[model samples]
Target: MTTKKQKSNSESHERKGVKRFESTTKGSSMIEFISKSETIFLTSLLFVIRLAAATWGIINDCDEVYNYWEPLHLFLHGEGFQTWEYSPIYAIRSYFYIYLHYVPAVIFTHMGLSKITVFTLVRVALGIFCLSGELYAYRAISKNINNTTARLFIFFTMFSSGVFQASSAFVPSSFCMAFVFYILGAYLNENWSFGIFCVAFSTLVGWPFSAILGLAIIIRMVFVKRHILAFIKISFLSGLCIGLTQLIVDSYHFGKPVIAPMNIVLYNVLSGPGPSLYGEEPISFYIKNLIVNWNVAIIASGIGFILSLWPSIGRKNQKGVTEYVSPIVWITATTGLWLLIFWKTTTQRRTIFIPNISIYCIFHCTYL
Candidate 1:
């Protein structure tokens, strides 16, 4: 009878243990669901905010006129604004980039939308497109850093005027910025090919100078002893495809075979005077711009970088990765270098500096 009692007690304890195991598993799954649902909800809300920003009226540069909206207008209505910049002789501007938006406008127009409505819709579309790039970068940041730091990055990026200004603007820098997102995203996600392709495509089809973003990553990768050979191959193939496609489409428009990228390179770089010939500024131009645009964020980012190099200030991150300085820190540093060197502009310019502000915020929290 004692033996029977012992067996019965042991069976009850085993059943209780099984119940606890099930309860714990259920709780973990619920927590995961809540986390994922919150992320989706927040991302959706952010998307809506960007859409509103697109429809809002903001004065953009004339380049947005001649380079994008104008070309698109002519393509759609058979006549619109034109500027000397698009002259066949120079071929500095791109129809390839314009067509990306033009095709969308075409579809929306076919649905009986007015030109103004179509244009507005397209603007919103472009804004969403740009926002996705930033989101990709956010995901990449989260992967490298803790959830807390990543959340800080998002909060800062959401309110940044520079991001709002650049995201909806129908310009090359704005367009290239999306590719910049993918490049950074792919790099952080460990997709070397997608990252290299973004860099190549942005350089080929958007702004040539945008390739500078890619160069920073390559240096970082080499430093970390990653696959340099694969990056080179991916870059070459992507650049070649983009170049060949651009040549074919542009040749038809210009009425002669023209290498637009080279024309831009020679005109911008090899020319004796450079872009400074048109408009120039003192060193204080950018300093003023940064103060006006991203004052708090930059301070945070500055702190973050300091923390990364010297980690004694904070507890080790949850990942047990003590020295995991985000590759994106280099982006802010490199882009800062670019701005310092080229403070002078051919036109009145506002530095499109959204990413750094986001970076600085994350860095601020990370190190502190």
Candidate 2:
């Protein structure tokens, strides 16, 4: 009787173990499925946002590109690669940007891609690029700080006014922001190959000022290094390689190598008020213009700017990453100073777009 009872109990125990194993396996599969589904949903959502924004910008600003479109059409139809007679006036400034439009023009010509479709594709690409940078920044920050805060910071940054306006309304600036993030990520990881690729691609994207952001990262890395000499050597070599590549491309196309339009704008601002500015204007003029045109963005940014500074006030003994705060502050300050200087000199109110938008994103991220 004892042996039989013991055998029965062993069989019962084995059955329970099997059931548990099956339950664990099922749970694991379910979790995997949910994770994949979530990823798909998020990706689709972002793509849609990008598409919508791009389409809107293209529809509204179609006239902006009309002058360039003729030449673009000619290039697409394989008429000739030589500069069009009208190219000097419209296409002279943003040759790099115009160059990229060639691919979309070709696609449109053959595949029946509408203006809307082309715009959507470009916007989607830009959005993905911008988001990728935010992701990289979040990853880096999370590595050094709490994961939750880092994620929140990234979310704020991505949705900030700077990002939204640049991605949605301004193509060149949006591309610049993406390149900035890419370079930042690569530099932070010390991935020389990836960094160079990012820089080259950014330069190709037609915003040389974007390279300034990259320079900032390189400077930061050098500052943190144990051997300043080695850091300088690497930095110089990298810059040289990038410069040479840019020179080759410029030689092949335009007679002279030129920085992007934003840089030109910056130079104009720095060089005292050009004709764009009616006359010498106070810096307040630019500030007022920003507040008037981008009220929502300005309000959001103002909140963010305040919050970013909040941590510094009355917090002495708080032992944490104070170093992280410096870069954000410096970027904001330098950009703001530059903008204000320009505003004081130039009457061209449009110049406010880049700095205001950029600051808005940075501030929003910091505050949020």
Candidate 3:
């Protein structure tokens, strides 16, 4: 009986020792995971600080464009859904953004909200959008690259001089940047439903041009070959839903099935400067404006463009050249197409935001 009792005591001690060892191992793993996560969080925080500094510098030197003025004015006057003759071009454009501003304006107007309140709210929202977009960009890049490299790319892209200028002067473009980031994140995961929802919400926030996000889906299908069919299907459905909803809203208010009148006028005024110089304006006019407005981005992008083609410069054996080659090709091709098809105007600074950001991502991911 004594021998048997001693044997049972020995077994119990061994079992306790094994359990303690396992617990220690798990504790170490949890600590390591937390440390890594904290590092990522710190990196993102630093990036935001850098971007905010750049943006603040630009805002201090520039005045806000009246982009939000028209919408605010209309809402203040109780015009509700009425169109402005000066910018009637909005009817054919994305109405969602205008409505976003309208909601606040309507509520405030009814409540007799002060001018200071309205302006403060708008500016605060803009700041949040900028920060959120940068965070999203960092997350997207980190998925494919190391955290340090992803943060560096996001920092450079967000704090670039051109981005700073656009964020300060171009209100709509700032919102568009946020939407683009959201779209990229959703696309990276092949989350078509989320992507489409983001695109729609972005379109409402003054990025009517978000209709162009469809191009990204097509590019993904042709190049990445990830969920191509689902992407196409969801994109079409979401677009239809957004369009029909807009039409119904407009028809109910303005007796029209399209956007507001002011938007139309604005488009016509800006759309005059097309890809080629053969139209009404001289080549120098567009060239001069492009250089002046996109000076910093253009210079950085030019360097990236050249670097992307040089295979022997930064060749990595692990991923091969395909990884480097694909992104470079995509950025260059899309940027060139954009310059060729769209009217290059300094006023539309937001046009270059996404492409520039993409270029920055490629540069850091491949070289840095």
Candidate 4:
């Protein structure tokens, strides 16, 4: 019962797949089928780069020191700066995240490491965690997309100054960025359970706003693929488990019942003063920041996003194409939606880091 258009689309995909395989095989040995040894070497090289950033990268925001690192320091040393967000009445920040990082610090400290050395080691752990997510995404990309895009993703992720700035930073946005990598990889690989759990984990344990990035996955499963039963079961189970853990941990830390995620969402989104209490900026603030961090890649992302939309729109009414909208379109459109939401509001550079992770993903979609 396959229609002509469906057959045409299938053949087109097969042709592209063959062309990609031939080009990767013939063009560069580096992008050839990655062997175990090459993966090991790549991991080691990337680890060295990340460790250097953890050791030497300057703190770009006071929030990193005051809001995150200091709370973690207090948990370890019995003293550190306290921010208003940590107050019991507000309780917008979660101690669950702090406790997660604390495990590594305590381990290093037990080894007779100095406090400074422990700090560096803790940051190194963060870098390693972030790197693991990138590696996962790289493998997924190579398997599901093409080796060329995967290679370029690795290069851009390694060399980008923004990665250095945020990779090891002890902040929720940075942590969420790692989760984003896993989410993107899972979406592309169609690992529904892992992807669902990651979205819950990022929203519950890291940043609540990060749930925006999961919209694409939700849409694909619920509306497009129509895995309604599986989606509900997985999302509810993961959300309940992670949310319960976060509630218990954060409530204990604050000496009261506190839903830290909801509290944060209310504060930032519903409160009258909100983030504007600190300051406000023109949309150019993020534009300048993105330009500095990504340079021409930002422009390319915009162009690629615009180009990606055409295919999805064209296929919308095609009866035989199983997926009317490409998953890449879902992803890029969500990122674009995020940009529009934050652009008109009080935008922070740190808040945009999760969305920024999608730039490389979008850039690769252009090749498709």
What lDDT tens digits, residue by residue, belong to model 2 across residues 1-368?
A: 56988999999999999989978976765454345564465456555655556656443343234534444545565453443322432223454455565664466547877755665565565566666675665554444333454545555554555455556443455565666565555654566556656665665444444454455454545563334666566656765675565445434555554444434555454554443544555656767766765556557766767666757544422234235444455445545555645555565444335523433444445545
Question: Any idea how many clashes model 3 has?
Answer: 18
In the order shown, the candidates' Cα RMSDs to the true structure are 6.2, 10.1, 9.4, 6.0
- Candidate that would win on TM-score: 4
Candidate 1 stretches with Cα past 4 Å from truth are 1-34, 311-328, 344-348, 352-368
Relative to the true structure, how large is the alpha-carbon lDDT of every model? 0.70, 0.53, 0.53, 0.81
Better of 3 and 4 by TM-score: 4
Model 2 lDDT, full chain set: 0.53
What is the descending TM-score order? 4, 1, 3, 2
Give per-residue CA lDDT, model 3, range 240-326, as digits (tens): 776677666655545555654235434545664422223344445556655665555556666666666766344552334334344
| Tens digit per residue, CA lDDT, model 4, 132-234 | 9889988887776667778788887888776776789898888888888888889888899999999999988888878888998899889987999999999
Reference-based TM-score of each model: 0.82, 0.62, 0.63, 0.87
lDDT of 3 at 234: 74
